[model samples]
Target: MGFHTFDIDRADALEDESRYRHLSAEELLAVLRPHPEMTVADLGSGTGFYTDDVAPHVGHLYAVDVQEAMHDIYREKGFPETVETVVADVASLPFDDGALDAAFSTMTYHEFAGEASLAELSRVLRPGGRFVVVDWTATGAGTAGPPTDERYSVGEAASALENAGFSVDRAESRTETFLCVASV
Candidate 1:
């Protein structure tokens, strides 16, 4: 019954109200049909609200976050040129290997702890590239609310992203949230 202690200005003020206004950044960019040149990544990227609308449809993004006050709230709200605010550690992700072409996390993966953020989302994606994964949906038993063992579901996050190699796609338990897409 503990470990609820946030600071980065109250977690960037609970991500500027209603937890970043309960997703729908144009329906997660229409389920990430993104491809303006692709290079996304947003693991726990708070306060920037889906990295400023996924940084004008991705040619770069990497808003990662351990929270240097959420990169000073994306440098006091001035983001534009394909973003780059990395404080990182969604259980350890820096980048490069296949070097991301897609990645995401809304509702921040139930505050992670499963297989170390699914092995850092299978080591920064890009074998096939795509890993959407939104969270919060256990309905009852604390009702998808955090602090109930840091909540998680969607079949335990798609079986912890298919045991961390990730190839399990499409898992939508949506509405109160739990969407998925994976590959790598």
Candidate 2:
């Protein structure tokens, strides 16, 4: 099976499981404190994990996801009124240029519908706005987390963002994750 279909089963299972959900949200906040008041868009906000935690810190949060089922959870969980849940694809988000102060995706970039996702991410931020990407490392035995063919290391993701018109500020490996902070 192709990469797109490779994790369909796991993604479906994730919709009902909250195991990694809270931990991911906490990890996101750890890196985003400096820009706490900035408007943020939690792209591919599966289960509103980061959405709910981030809403309290950011000026506003656009909790966007392509899945209605996920959005329904956001609503049911009674996320702060500050969150605006929108149903949309990550690669083709329906946001406007310079409209966001920052954007974040946790363990979601590998699932990009295609290259258009990177372009869309670069297009929506203001010139100096930050883009924080937190995803599983694409190497080491922990590579077991994502399909080998579809993952990217921090270096690879940094290069892709640079190609998409971002000025990479940081690209480094964490204990078990890869992270990058870039400016559009």
Candidate 3:
């Protein structure tokens, strides 16, 4: 339902640029369709890595992470003025109903992937708002990212979203990761 490993010790690994090979910022922005006036949230935002990549495009961006220590590292690195850190779980976001214009999680989905979390996402995102997920897929060979068993396939992600009351727009797989986009 929520992330169990709130380890800040691996914070530096989150900053690795090589991760873009799995999901690039350009691809994320394209799928997210972010607007200048949009209020977005980076779900499971670790050290503001991908959050920083998205900040300049959005009017307001919430870096939501379960770990405050990760937010501390994000603050120390100095994020954009538009980026605000919110320490919270994916299953229990602090925002009101229909509060987010869009939300996304970068490599952190498996940690909080479940019906409750998906339902919470569906509850917070406004009608027609986008919710994109880019994470390691279970079908991939055991290489980088989390173990294959812990990951969700694109189909699983799409099915979970559909069950949670969101309409899945696109669900595709890469060599090691999957991209699933859903709309509220």
Candidate 4:
């Protein structure tokens, strides 16, 4: 199981630009490599922060979150034409099998890391589709994001994806975060 869910009251913090210092939009876009015709999902999307960054690049973007209140907050922020809000958990998405061309999660992996969640990700993504994850690392200093004990190291995440039948192409650990790119 993962850590506790984020507090809905702190949803505003998710929109802070300073968060880019940990995971920038440019860096996420570079790894995501979204094409105009591809369909993508922003898993655990809160307030559509990073989701907005990827929306313009994809044909369809699903801002998926377990909390409908978060979706309400995103709606107030103005959703893009291509972005659709889906109230669903990562372990049990409403998408069809192989419906998505790709999927990405920003700083929410620790909250949803488990066998069921990873398997569902593999099921929804098309063959050769990418799954990008950027989250606080267990090896990091306890200064930002979740506590170290509640996080996963890059190696643990990579191994979990591999065990879920994904081919990990990139796994890098930075000062406070880890980025992992895998393909179904």
Candidate 5:
């Protein structure tokens, strides 16, 4: 794999509520501020775990995952009508320029963090569009998520977003994770 991808065999684990201990639905919505009129995309939407949380709040959601099998798992679980399955990489999305009103990723940033992917996100989001990222931090103790060596720090993510033409509004580190809010 080019990056650390989630295994579809463990798709059931993603639906567990305990997974929210790192980043809750409340916190994600608070930062994403998804509205009934907003069109959003959930990048690296594994099994639509978090996608199911945000779909109801947004007018539309594109559940993007590199693995089609993940989407199949989500389909079996049933998702909101607002949710649309999209199989694509973050580096290359099938959307027009400024197509999304807002976008977010949960525990998936490390899998897609790069200049090309970040720049693609910047290209797809409208001006002033918000992009919230919650992922395992490199500074973590390895209790949850990927190994420290495989993760990126908040500073690194912030810098990459900035290099991709995003203005980071908020960047903070939690015990084992980081939250970064960047605007296009």
Candidate 6:
């Protein structure tokens, strides 16, 4: 099971630009390689931080979050024309089968990592669709993000994706985080 959901009061902290130090928008875009015609989702898109960065690059961007308040915060900031807020859980998405060309999550893998969520993601993405995940690793120093005990190592995450029938093409464990790119 995943850890607790983020405190809504701390939603403001999610807008901090310094968070790029953990997972840069450039790195995420490179991993996704999104095209202007590709449909994508920003899973757990709180405050639409990285979602905004990816919206203009994709045909449609779904800012999915379990918390409607997070979407409310995003609305206050403004949404891209192509971006739509979806109040849903990763384990039970509202999208149809093979509806997405790609999906990515920034520092949110731990909060929604599980078999049900992975299967839902696999169900929504078409064949050869990409799924990029960047999150604080279990092996990290615990100087930032969640507690180390609540996180997953890159190997563990890779195994989870593999079990979900995803072909992991790229996986890297950085100083404090892990980046895993998989395709259905």
lDDT tens digits by residue: candidate 4, 49-148: 9999999999999999999999999999899999999999899999999999999999999999999999999999999999999999999997988888
User: Candidate 5 residues 36-86, lDDT tens each?
Assistant: 999999999989889988999989999999999999988888999999999
Q: What is the clash count of model 2?
A: 1
Worst 10 residues of 4 by lDDT: 1-10
Better of 1 and 6 by lDDT: 6
Q: Please list the residue runs of candidate 5 whose C-alpha ends up more than 4 Å from where it truly belongs after superposition.
A: none
Writing each residue's lDDT as its tens digit, candidate 2 over 1-184 gives 1334223334444444363542465666776653556878987786676677788887789988777777775577678877888887767777887888888877777767246777888788877888888776667456345665667788888888888888998888765568888888
User: Quick one: best lDDT, which candidate?
Assistant: 4
Off by over 4 Å in 6: none
Candidates 2 and 5, the one with greater lDDT: 5
How well is each residue in 1-184 modelled by candidate 6, as lDDT tens digits?
Answer: 4458788999999999998998888988889999999999999999999999899899999999999999999999899999999999899999999999999998899999999999999999999999999999999999998999889999999999999999999999999999999999
Q: TM-score of each candidate?
A: 0.32, 0.81, 0.96, 0.98, 0.98, 0.98
Worst 10 residues of 3 by lDDT: 1-10
Instruction: Report lDDT (CA) for all predictions.
Output: 0.73, 0.72, 0.89, 0.94, 0.93, 0.94
Single out the weakest 10-residue window by summed lDDT for candidate 6.
Answer: 1-10
Enumerate clash totals for all models, in the order shown. Answer: 0, 1, 0, 0, 0, 0
Mind giving the per-residue lDDT tens digits that candidate 3 earns over 51-130? 99999999999999888899989989999999999988889999999999999999888999898888898889999999
How many clashes show up in model 6?
0
lDDT score, candidate 3: 0.89
- TM match of model 6 to true structure: 0.98
